[model samples]
Target: MTLVIKPLRKAVLPVAGLGTRFLPATKAMPKEMLPVVDRPLIQYAIDEARAAGIEEFCLITGRGKDSLIDYFDVAFELETTLRERNKLDALEALGPTSIEAGALSAVRQQEPLGLGHAIWCARSFIGDDPFAILLPDDVVKSDVPCLKQLVDVYNQTGGNVLAVTEVPREHTNRYGILKTGEDDGRLVEVKGLVEKPKPEDAPSNLSIIGRYILTADVMPHLSKLERGAGGEVQLTDAMAKVIGHAPFHGLRYEGRRFDCGNKVGYLEAQIAFSIDRPDLGDAVRAFLKNYTG
Candidate 1:
């Protein structure tokens, strides 16, 4: 028998959540539209997806999130003004933000369901191909984009690829923890997944992060729409259904992951990203000195 692995081309970004954690800041805007340094959190996720050779993207959005749909659309009026003013630098900056022709799509998640339901809303856009699901909340800064790392593994292993990181045993109750069957440093055989299990009953410290490269077959399981974990449709529950039948593995990606979902993490991401910028690094570093006084 011969093995055939499809080239990963499409990515789904679930950005529909009401950013209740951020309160008034998110009261009017989607949390994804929140800036990290110069760019919004969603932009970083898009840049990463593009770097991973993704040709198309499906954005799962909710009410008050139309800004995301407008973000990538060509700003004809803005472009016209910039062109007339000969602002070539500003024009060039927009190049990376442009999604491929007919490749950008936005699907609405009618309800404030869980992550699994959010992903299911994009099923029509997913069709029947191997695709990636990237959560904008987890902004990973890496020489090799996090999703690209998993795609490379999927190329060699040919099944499901989940980007994972080791969490503290005490923190296991907060995330989908993985039980490893074999350890190979960067890659490990996924024996089982326990969603937010108590610290003592946890199998391993390996916890699933926001990045995922799932095969099309997993959609059917999600279609069942069974509620799990927090009484909401859990993506972990759907993924667990296909555990034994698929080639699932957790990869310890080499990167600095910033959880932009929470307040502290969001502030940290701003500082971290600012430090990486050539123009802003010096000014930001200088500002940090005044805080000691």
Candidate 2:
């Protein structure tokens, strides 16, 4: 018998939205730059990818999103100034966050197309290997990184895998819902996927999250996919085409998911992360007590 180990080395981050909901803050900064605690939102996504053993990063960006690319670049002048000021700890913090040269690349989405288009822009970067996709808006806090959990499943299945969670029946319209064929603990065999289907029409309550391990074969479907629901080409629609052709499975992630795309979710993430931090837990607890009082 021969053993095979598939290579999962690259991750694509789609970050080209206008972020209109965030208003003035997003007017000057990319939404991904908004801080969850002390670290920016994009940092959390990148950290998760690094934890998953992904070596290369591909960011699909749009106009005025240069700051996101700069965030991961080495700041020689800033490092020098911090070094001179004896801020060695801060300097070291920046070191681990820096993506190695040639390890990170960016492709412009040009238009505010959609998730599918943003991912399609990275076709060259993805080449012929399987790649991971991380949506920074969905910040997952867990002992094991969310993508890493899915990667472990991919190692066993050797096919496309997506992160899935059960949402309320009423909320099925709010996400890409999966139609399941079979369940084996955490892995659910995907029969089909419906994008934001009505509660009555939804195939199953299993809602798809933002993390995915996609095969390169998906490129063709994304390129030719018709715009569905909201006049935009949805990634779900593209993935749906490859369902039975390839072994598509969904992994139910073990963690709390904060949908940082909305104001309420973002605020909740701040409170949740703050309560988890030992340095600020006491003060944060007291503040919450007084706030509730």
- Using Cα atoms with residue i matched to residue i, what is each candidate's TM-score against the true structure? 0.97, 0.97
Model 2 alpha-carbon drift over 4 Å, by segment: 1-5
lDDT of 1 at 220: 97
Worst 10 residues of 2 by lDDT: 1-10
Residue 207, candidate 2: Cα error in Å is 0.5
Instruction: Quote the lDDT for 160 in model 1.
Output: 91
Candidate 2 lDDT over residue span 132-163, tens digit each? 99999999989999999999988988779999
Local error of candidate 1 at 143, Å? 1.0
Q: Give the winner by TM-score.
A: 1
- lDDT at 171, model 1: 96
CA lDDT, candidate 1, residue 126:
85
